[model samples]
Target chain A: MSTRKQEFLAGARNTFPLLLGAFPFGLIYGALAVTSGLSVGAAMAMSAFVFAGSAQFIAVGLVAAHAPVLIIILTTLIVNLRHMLYSATLLPYLKKLPQTWRIPLAFGLTDETFAVAIHRFRKNDSSRFKHWYQFGSSLAMYLNWQLWCFLGLVLGDRIPDASGWGLDVAMPITFIGMLIPFVKNIPTVVCVLTAGAVSLLTLGMPYKLGIIVAAFMGILAGFITEQTGKKIQVEIQV
Target chain B: MTANEWLMILGMMGVTFGIRYFLLALADRIRMPSPVEVSLQYIPPAVLIAITLPAVILPHGEWHFSFTNPYLVAAVIAAGCGLLTKNLLATIACGLAAFFAYQILLSS
Candidate 1:
C-alpha cells in the first residue's frame, strides 16, 4: 500500500533520530573547519562537495597542518573505504535499477542512509519504487549535513571545543540501537564481541586503521564460528 | 577559493564518490564468491561494533574503563535501556541524558 511519496516520507521520517545524531557532527565540522584556517567559503564548499562528515573533519585538520593535497585525498580514500562495504551490502537491493536512478542514490549514500535504507530493503514488501525510500534517506542526510555545516560556519568561534561537547556520543548510541537486532544469533554475538575486543586492543593504529582491522577480525571470527556451529549440528544429527 | 583549496575539496569529492559507487556500478560485472557472500551479512554489525565499542569504552581514545568515564557509564545504561525497550528513541534519550548527567556529576 506504499506509494513513492509515502515510501520517501517514511524513509525521511525514520531517519529523524539519525539526523539529530549527525547534527553536532556536521556543526562541529563546519565550525572547526573555519576556525582551523579554511575560509568560510572553502569550508562550506567542502561540505557541499565532499559531504562525508568524518573525512571532511579530518581533511580540515590536515589542511590546518599544511598537509599536501595528495595526502588529504589519500586519507579520504582510506577513511571512506567503509562506504564500499555499505555499497556492496546494498547492491543486491539496488542492482536492478538504471544508471539514472543508481547515480543519485549512490551519491547520497552515507552511514546513516545505509543503516536506515538497509532495514527497509530487508523488509518484506511489494512496492515498485523502493529505491525512492533510499532516495529519501540519502537526501535527508545530505540536506541535514549541509544545514548543520552552514550553522557551524555562521557560529564560528562562538562554539569553541565543539568536539569536547560530547555530542559525538550520538554516533555510538544510535549505532548501539541499530546493532541490537543484528545480535540475534550466536555468530553475530561472537562477531560483536570479537570486534569490540580487537578495537580496544588495536586502538593505536593510525588513520583509523584499527577500525578496518577489527572489522576483518570480527568477520573472520564470525565466519569460523558459523562453520564450526554447522559442523557440530551435522555431527549431532548423525 | 584558492586553486589549492579547490583542489583539495574536489579531490576528496572524487575519491569518496568513486569508492561509494564502485561496487554499485559493477553489481552485474562482479559477483562475490559464495563464502564472501555469506560473510557479507556480518559486515554491518562487525563494523558498527568496531566503531561504537571503542568510542564508548575508550571515550578519550585511551583505556579508562572505570566509573569515572561518563561515556562508558552512559553507554552501559543506554544498552540496558535498549535491550529492555527495544526502542531506538528510548535508547538515544537515555544514553544522552545519562552522558550529560554523569559529566556534570564528575566535574562538580
Candidate 2:
C-alpha cells in the first residue's frame, strides 16, 4: 500500500472508537430532524452539508419550534463556536499545505477528527503524510455519520413519534458522558457548573438564547478560573 | 423542502463552512493571543454543558426536577457511568437502559 493510503487507514482505524459513540448520536439527529418537520432530503442534505452533529440537533429543535431563520443561524453559529478553537489549534500544522488540501480538511474538521488529527500531529514523526491521516479520520467519520443519518431518516419515517419516545434523552446523556473525562481541574468544573446553572436559570428565554448566553458565561468563568489557578501555581513556585 | 427551509439549510451550510474555514485559511497571517488560546480550551466543556443541561433538566420546556423526570434520573446515572468507566458506549448504554426502565415503571 502507498504511504498515504497507510496513513489514511491508520487515521480511520484510530477513529473507530469515536465512531461508535457518534453512531447513535447521528441516528438520533436524523430521526429528530424528520420529527422536526424537515423533509428527508433536507435532513440528509444537512448531514451532508453542515456535518456538525450538535449544530444539526440544535437546528432541528429550532426548526420544530418555528424559530426565525435568523435565530436558527445564530443559534447554530453559537453552538459551533468551538470549531474556531479547533481551527486555531490545527492551523500551525496545516499551514504548509496548499489551499486544495486545506479546504477539504477544514470542512471535515469535526470534533472527532480534530481529536484524532491533533494526536497524530503531536507525534514526532517526520512524515509529510500527516494530513492524509487527518483526511482518513475525517473521511471515516464523515461516511459513518452519513450512513447512520440515512438509517435514522429511514427509521424516522416509520416511527413518527421517535422524539416522544424519549430517545432524545440519550443526547444529553451522551454529552454528559463526553463532559466527565474533561473535568480534571477546578477550571473545568467551574466551567461546567456555571454553564449548567445558567442554562437552567435561563430556561424560559426566547429563541433558545439561554444556551448562547450560558455558553459565553461559562467560557468566561472558566477562563477566569484558569488564569487565577495559574497565578496561584506561580506564587507557590516562588 | 420549501424555499424557506432550503434557505435555512443553505444559510447554515454557508455559516458552518465559513467558521470552520476561517482561521485555518488565515493561519499564516494571524497569530492567536495567549489569553484567547487559554480561553479556547474551556469552550468545549462550557458549550457542551450549556447545551446538555437544558435538555436534561428541562426536557419538556418546563422545569421538571422530580423523580418523574426520567431524563434527569438517567442523566445522573449516565454521569456516574461516565465517571466510573470513562467509556462512551458504556455510559450511553447505562443511560438508555435507565431511561427505558424508568419509562416502564412510571407508565405502569
Candidate 3:
C-alpha cells in the first residue's frame, strides 16, 4: 500500500473506538429528529449539511417546540461554537494543505474526528500524508453518522416512542466516559465541575441557552485558575 | 419540509460551516491570543461536561437527584466504570445495563 493509503487506514482504525460511541448517538438523533416533527429529508439534510451531532439534536428539539427561526439559528450556533476552537487548534497543522483539502477537512471536523486527528497531528510525523489520515478519519465518521441516522429514521417510523426508550441516556454516559480520562489536573477538574454545576443550575433556561452560558463560565474558570496558579508559583519562587 | 424549516436548516448549515472554516481560512494571517490558546485546552472538557450534565442529572428537564431516577444512578455508575477502566465500550455497556435494571426495579 502507498503511504497515503496506510495513513488513511490508520486514521480509520484509530477512529473505530469513537465511532462505536457515536453510532448510537446518531441513531438517537435521527429517531428523535423524526419524532420531533422533522421530515426524514430534513433530518438527513441537517446531518449532511450541519454535520454537528449535538447542534442537530438541539435544532430538532427547537423545531418541535415551534421555536422561531432566529432562536434555532442562534441556539445551534452557540452549541457549535466549540468548532471555532477546534479550527483554531488544527489551523497550524492544516495551513500547508490546499483549499481542496482544507474545505472538506473543515466540514468533516467533529468532536470525534478532532479528538483522533489531534492525536495524529501531535505525533508530528515527517510524512507528507498526515492530512490523508485526517481525511480518512473524517470520511469514516461522516459516513458512519449518515448510516446510523438513516437507520434511526426508519426505526423511528415503525416505533413511535423510540426516544422514550431511555436510549438518550447513553449520550450523557458516553460524554462522561470521554470526560473522565481528561480530568488529569486541577484546571481540567475545575473546568468540568464549574461547567457541570452551572448547567445543572440553569437547566430551565429556554432555547437551552444554559449550555452556552455554562461553557463560557467553565472556560473562564479554568483560565483564571491556571493564571492564578502560575502567579502563586512565581510568588513562592521569589 | 416547510419553507420555514428549510430556512432554519440552511441557516444552521451556514453558521456551523462558517465557524469551523473561519480560523482555518485565515490560518496564515491570524494568531490566537495566548490566553485564548491556554483556555482552548479546557474547552473540550468544559463543553462536554456542560452538554452531558444536564442530560444525565435532569433527563426530564427537571432535578431528579433521588435514587429512583435511573438516569442519575446509571450515569454515576457509568462514570465510575469509565474512571476505573477508561474503556468506552465497557462504560456504555455498564451504563445501559444499570439503566435498564433500574427501570425494571422501578416497575417491579
- Scored by DockQ, the top model is 1
TM-score rank order: 1, 3, 2
lDDT of 2 by residue, A103-215 (tens): 99988988778766776887887888999999999999999999999998899768666667776676687677667766788998898899889988887786566776887
lDDT pick, better of 1 and 3: 1
- Interface DockQ per candidate: 0.78, 0.62, 0.69
Counting clashing residue pairs in each candidate, in order, gives 0, 0, 0
The stretch of ten residues in a row with the least summed lDDT in candidate 3 chain A is A116-125
Poorest 10 consecutive residues of model 1 chain A by lDDT? A155-164
Please, what are the lDDT tens digits per residue for candidate 1 over residues A38-102? 98989999888888887888898898899999999999998888888888888888889888888
DockQ of 1: 0.78
What TM-score does chain A of model 2 get? 0.76
For residues B35-54, write the lDDT of model 1, one tens digit per residue.
88888888889988988988
The residue pairs in collision within model 1 are: none
| Candidates ranked by DockQ | 1, 3, 2
Question: What value does the lDDT take at residue A63 in candidate 1?
Answer: 88
Candidate ordering by lDDT (highest first) = 1, 3, 2
